[model samples]
Target: MRSYSSYVLIAVATLLVTCHALHKCPGIPGIPGLPGRDGLKGQIHLPGLLGPPGSLIGRPGRHGLPWLQGLPDSLDTERHDVLVNLKHRLSRLEGVLALNGKIREVGDKILASNGREVDFASALQSCEEAGGTIATPKNEEENKAILGIVKQYNRYAYLGIKEGQTSGQFMYINGTPLNYTKWHQYEPNGKGMEKCVEMYTDGSWNDKKCNVNRLTICEF
Candidate 1:
């Protein structure tokens, strides 16, 4: 009877060992779970912010496109305003000069005399201070214009010409050679001794001594 009991006990122990090896405790439910695949991408959408009112172009009461806001105008309005103001001022200047009649405009050049008689140096200083130069005629029309003033005052006026280092050769105050001249016959006879020039009432020019007082005529 004791031997039979021992055999039964051994069989039970062998069966328990085989069952424990075959079955696991499920590893604590695999910690969490297997990683899931990524989801599909979503569509892009832009968020709007408060902006300025839209323009009424192409549609009444409708705003302009957001991207076109604050754009510059096609026309330069500031430049236009400046031009208009300049033209208005010029017209007023023309009217005033006409009324005074002391100044004469020939083409774009304006010739005027202040009725003051002074030496060449003083005359040059006066004209330059007033933003002009002693009357320098470059053509027949300009010479005639200066002549009118000379005749008006009935006095000879100093011309803006000087004897060059070459003696009888004359030039403008800035050292440019004379492009036009109305020298009186047998005039310019003083040579280097008469460095300054004066205009006669007959629209002719004569070289004269610089110290002699002559009419103060200026050209602008």
Candidate 2:
């Protein structure tokens, strides 16, 4: 019984010692786990503030193509020229109308169809002012036409025909020969030193003084 008691005491001491050693020892480190699987990607961030102004600027864009040319006007250059010429002719016609009391156009010739009575010298001046000469008949038809125009006033009219260098011989004011004449019987007998010619209402002509006043005629 004493031996049994001794064994029990020894076992108890051994158990106590083992329990104390276990309590004092440090714990073993565990193996690091594989890095945790990457978490879901985060949201995108906002843009940063603008940087400082640049030193150099880009070149200007090419100038826009020149504006398309406008279409030409209805009156082209040639038509414009014609219009200007017509305007000039109209202005001239207006001037002619103002100068002559009445005018008649006879196949490219403009004549004073009607005129007031004035002295021969004054009549010549008026004709010159109107850019014409005294009435000068070129043929029998023209003489008849002139007589018809002047006879309406029922008066003798001075003619452009006058005595040439030779007395009693007549010629036109333009120095042309007077190839035609219709004289009343026994008239123009070189009476009173007559130098100019006058046409009667009856279409006859006679020598007369230049100072005589009568209805006038002008031709151009």
Backbone clash numbers for all candidates listed? 3, 0
The per-residue C-alpha lDDT of model 2 at residue 111 equals 66
After aligning candidate 2 to the native by TM-score, how far in Å is the CA of 52 from where it should be? 66
Candidate 1 lDDT, 58-155, residue by residue in tens: 22223565533342343347678889999999888977986788789998988888899999999999999999999999999999999999999999
Q: TM-score of predicted model 1?
A: 0.63
lDDT of 2 by residue, 1-220 (tens): 4485565555445434654566532223334444559644433222222112221122322343232222245435668999999999976885687455355555555567355888778888888888888887767677776786676677889888888778777888878887888877887787448888888888888888898888888888
Model 2 clash pairs are none
Error of 1 at 169 (Å): 1.2
Best by TM-score: 1
User: What is candidate 1's local distance difference test score?
Assistant: 0.80
**Alpha-carbon lDDT, every model:** 0.80, 0.68
Error of 2 at 185 (Å): 2.6
Task: Give the C-alpha miss distance for residue 34 in model 2, angstroms.
Answer: 95
